[model samples]
Target: MNFHRTEVRHRAVARLRAGAKNADVAREFDIPLGTISYWRHMDRAKRGECPGAHDPKCPRCDGRELDSAAYSYLLALYLGDGHIIQYSAHRVPSLMITCDDAWPGLMNACETAMRKVFPDNSVCRVRKTGCHNVKVYSKHLWCMFPQHGEGKKHERSLVLEPWQQQIVDAHPWQFIRGLIHSDGCRITNWTTRRVGGERKRYEYPRYFFTNTSTDIIQLCTDTLDRVGVEWKPARQKSRKAENISVARKASVALMDQHIGPKY
Candidate 1:
């Protein structure tokens, strides 16, 4: 069994030790009654000790210190394309981020961030039709990033804690890079013009970020402002969607200097 399965078993045993009925514990946790009975027997044999106590030496159970850069990147990815889901049957939680297969670097970055957060946990990758789902199994992730909630991000209120905001404030460019790599792109815009009675073409590169969450868009724009990158708000056909455009040559140059393009 994996670490997640072991954690679930330990919790079930803990509840059994707390005077909870075997049937009740099994029902609540969706575990087999036989499994609960076995846990109860083991607990009684062990003098009623709680099995949920994590091993201090096990890094997966004990966790590790958060890396500021990896965490900031993970936070931006969560705000952009990452989500957390809890399994009612097993009572296990998992964090997943789906990135386009074409951009394997972003997917690798997601995996790296997850590993940094939980140094001992395995970061699983599942390939879908066109994207790859990078996932990490741990209930602790939900505790770390409480921003994960129900429904679309735009429909809910998003706020960062003082510590998280401090990280963002300290590394705004990295945060912006993660956000842009997930939900934004850099492309060249071309236009035709008539100069001195002659047809001419002009090409310029710009960065565009679009998202459904107003708070996220605001965060992106605010970070850009902090980095001295000027941006303009663009109209979206749907009221739910918001866009930020950095088309000025100077702004694009600045972004290129800091963020460049995600591979």
Candidate 2:
């Protein structure tokens, strides 16, 4: 609640410096995990340990420190470019990592979580095709773009790849909610959605992504569901667009209601 509490900030930084887990510190202080990470990152920047601050020409520039605005931009870039951008502009292209044995890690991680949350939900490898070009690798963070409707606020109409979009559509609530819950940061007015010129039906809705500590088991189960792919209505909605609005509204409402600033 108190965003600018210096003592809390200092204590969090100290804990991080002492090699404590960001989540642990966040849980202890009843703050969003992100707030703790932001503070720790800021502290690290002050000490000249940030990744982007690796410029020998200018050992340090305060601008390299990721303030709120920079953080949003970085998030956008990650989602839009799949964390690693290959191209942009009129023909935006990104390199989706690929490998044969890469998926085991992801599958293992997601499977573990699915068992806990939904025991009956099982993950199965449906098929394999070279033409489809299924590639997988491991990374701390991933890119995904969320979707938004007309008259709503979100990011621009950038198209992330199919797999990336599948990840988002399947688990937007989990992705955003997990971040807010895990991070101690409270987003005052953040909108993690994508906007479009017209209301056209895109096969995929959004991008699904994760942080370093994503639950592999849960992720695996969720991914299976995504692969299987179905849509359902929220309990509460109007009659105007019952079928279409349910999925859209439910997705947005969950993100908006529970995925705000937290610690």
**lDDT leader:** 1
Please provide, for model 2 over 1-263, each residue's C-alpha lDDT reduced to its tens digit, 9 standing for 90 to 100. 34446677778778889999999999988889877787787678668888765322210222222122222222232332122332212122232322124334433333333233222223233234531122222111122222222321212343445644444454554443332222212222323444575454334222223222223223323533553433342233333322111124444344446343331
Please provide, for model 1 over 68-175, each residue's C-alpha lDDT reduced to its tens digit, 9 standing for 90 to 100. 888888889989998988755444578889999899888888888888866756789998999998998775766678788889898998888887898899989889
In order, candidate lDDTs are 0.82, 0.38
Candidate 2 lDDT trough over 10 residues, lowest sum: 131-140
For model 2, how many clashes? Answer: 28
> Number of clashing residue pairs in every model?
0, 28
Best by TM-score: 1
lDDT of 1 at 31: 74
Compared with the true structure, model 2 gives a TM-score of 0.22
